[model samples]
Target: MLPISYSSLNNSRVNRDGSSRYRRFIPEYFRRIFHYPQMDIEYTFWIMFYLCFNPSRVYKITYWHKQTKNQWARDDPAFVAICVFFMAIASMSYAIAFHYLSFFHIIKTIFWAVCVDFISLGLVVATVGWWVTNKFLRVSAHNHSVDQNVEWLYAFDIHCNSFFPLFIILYVIQFFLLPILLSSSFLSTFLSNSLYFIAFVYYYYITFLGYNALPFLQHTVAFLYPIILIFTFYVLGVVLNINFTISIMRFYFGQ
Candidate 1:
């Protein structure tokens, strides 16, 4: 008879069949996101969006880590690709609505946003994250093995999936929140800023949880990794000639 670990016992909810809980198909992932446990609240991809929005989700992630001891993050490429596509479409739509971008400009903008913002940035951060984890962290064998440590592509996929929730929020901001900010009314202005601030905090906080989702990295290191990557991505943005401010201003002023 084998002994059951406390962690395995707790994760029975997600790992009931001793299989990966991550979904790879976009349709299934989206479909599954809506169904939560009636009382306990199962964390699905869609639910992760709301959770990512809430600052309190950090505690949830921490608690989840404690309960499941499952730190290997989900690696869902289809979902990540869909999020990237939606973000590009939303930005392009916003630009077209304001008459700021031609179809050709839209194509270029989409390429830059998808290639630089999502794919390239995700790769850089994930690669760095994997290096850090492989070097410094004491990962669990159940989470990842030494052989898996060299699989930077797997790390990249995990980070890409992690970007899904943030991308969804960005889509909302691009399509709806920016328009609200454009409103000259006092209430709109207040609400827009407040929402943006909330989203900003939530994005970083969830990203912190994501870094921790890499097995065995200290929580503090997890918290700091995302902050550093934000700066790194900004630098990459400049190198790629992608100015988020200028793009938004173009949308705002229809320049």
Candidate 2:
């Protein structure tokens, strides 16, 4: 059965569709994380249209199927907002612990990496915030008229169409060109890029497929991501001796 929040919207069996790769084991997480915006717009309010023909009791069931299904549903914006709130709190805690407390000896290199990460995340939040605020501030009966075509309703359409291609081009330039430019021009190594990319792909794989490795792989990855940065910087420090500090500062600043 559907949750009460979505039941009124005419949801179907959560597992009726069989095409999802995670259907057999972890449908819930995959559904919640990846399904919502797409289903909300394109389907007939039929949540399970992507799954099996016959629906099961997604809310009441407590076994693997229901657990996974619930995990998926939690990706809805309603739940994500709560998760992000906690994540914000955690980020603040990290700042307090690393920047304020005189506890662990956070290498100067990792400290700068965290700053870069915070700045990037800050810009994402700011730009999205401005766009959303401006969008609503400009709303008018004529602009958002119910009678108008959706194409006209969402003038952001053309921008969306171009976003992916632009991202691809920039990524190609960054991935292929940035390294060459940085290595040859700036005389820097790509250590941070490599470590973070591993963490990213690992996180995505786990989010999509879950861990299929030995019992410790999940735990290892969970702990290794941050430690990887620390360890990488430590190695550089050992290799470069006294020059490591200056080089790392330059890399972080130039980045």
Candidate 3:
């Protein structure tokens, strides 16, 4: 018999249908979470940069990942970790910029922003995406012995990828425009809500791209349907003179 190489061993772990075994995947993912040195910060940053400028290229990488790794989801946690780090920093900056006096309030702001907004909401969105795709979008395995399902971790990865752009637009870019966005004028309200509109539309677009990249998935355009609802709300927000950015700030820091 020939020697068992590491590559063969790794390939053997993937199911014949090309889905990853979460039994092995979960522990490995979480284990790597604390191993900072092993994380590829450069690659993660590259993903974030392209996600903002050329998001389709980023999903192309996901396709390449499936070709090489036999799975559509990322095995690395570096992207998720870096995203949470950025979220925490943005939350802290907002707390300080808003002149939050109490340390408890500052910590609470960070907690809500990072834990609730990013992590909790991410989990919910990811779960829904995972279930919806697997239930309705996946190809039937009538001929094949086994069916492929969209991995939950991969769904969460898409959320992280999509959320990064939203975070940059709302948390980082919007922060710099606080002076104007916080003003009590129609122009300010329109601009601020427009920022939210753009951010959410980009989020859903990236999400659609992510699901579309999966060869086992069909009808991925359904992911973009939310944009229509978002646009309708944007029009309503503009008509109502609501500043989404200011409202979010008020919710966060009571400003």
Candidate 4:
């Protein structure tokens, strides 16, 4: 007979066969979304700040979370709510700075930024990440009495973590540098492409960190492979003198 740790016993009550509790995660997550008193806004902001300045530190917290809470994914919706709020604010700032004064245009920009870019794309990326890790990266079940699988919500949490830094770079920092980045010069083009390159590289690197932190996952380096493709595209963009920021602006606001 083996001693069962408190964490394991607690997890058994919630997870049972491993995934039943996660099936109810969405509804419960949404239910708590509007329950502002329960949301840890300050801690969520701390995670957001570290995500930009010291991303590995953010994932380290995730590891601690698993040990204490017996789950890899966050049960609180505060982070999601804050992310949506920030995305909306950034979109509005861009619209105002770009002189998109019409009410409909502002609403459209916010819709696309929040709904399409953040939420919809996040769903696709999270699903892909969740499937890939669970399908190919999980340790063999025979190795442990209880099989461990990456949670879908955890995968989405990784996406949210990765996207925050990217949002700061492309949305916040890029906005301040637009006067120079949008100029018609080779240096401007290089700088713009470099910003995108760094943003995407950090995105994938943080993503790799998220999965690598899991005790049951292996060969997490596969997540970093996208950086090679990103670098290739960066070189092509520079060779063609393509300013990615301006291109994105054109796509969003037709500037």
**Which candidate achieves the best lDDT against the true structure?**
4
Predicted structure 3: lDDT: 0.90
| TM-score winner between candidates 2 and 3 | 3
**Model 3 segments beyond 4 Å from truth?**
1-26, 142-146
Q: How well does each candidate superpose onto the true structure, as a TM-score? A: 0.54, 0.22, 0.88, 0.88
Error of 3 at 248 (Å): 1.5
TM-score of 3: 0.88
* Candidate 1: clashing pairs of residues: none
lDDT of 4 by residue, 163-235 (tens): 9999989999999999999897999999999999999999999999999999889999999999999999999
lDDT of 1 at 136: 66
Residue-level lDDT of model 1, residues 31-63, one tens digit each, is: 444543222233444545555555345344544
- List candidate 2 stretches off by more than 4 Å: 1-139, 142-163, 178-180, 183-255
Give the per-residue lDDT of model 3 (tens digit) for 195-245.
999999999999999999887889999999999999999999999998898
**Candidate 4 TM-score, true structure as reference:** 0.88
Clashes of 4: 0
The root-mean-square deviation over C-alpha atoms between each candidate and the true structure, in angstroms, is: 12.1, 19.7, 7.2, 8.8
Candidate 3: the clashing residue pairs are none
**Between which residue pairs do clashes occur in model 4?**
none
**Residue-level lDDT tens digits of model 2 in 128-162:** 43344334322334454432111221112112221
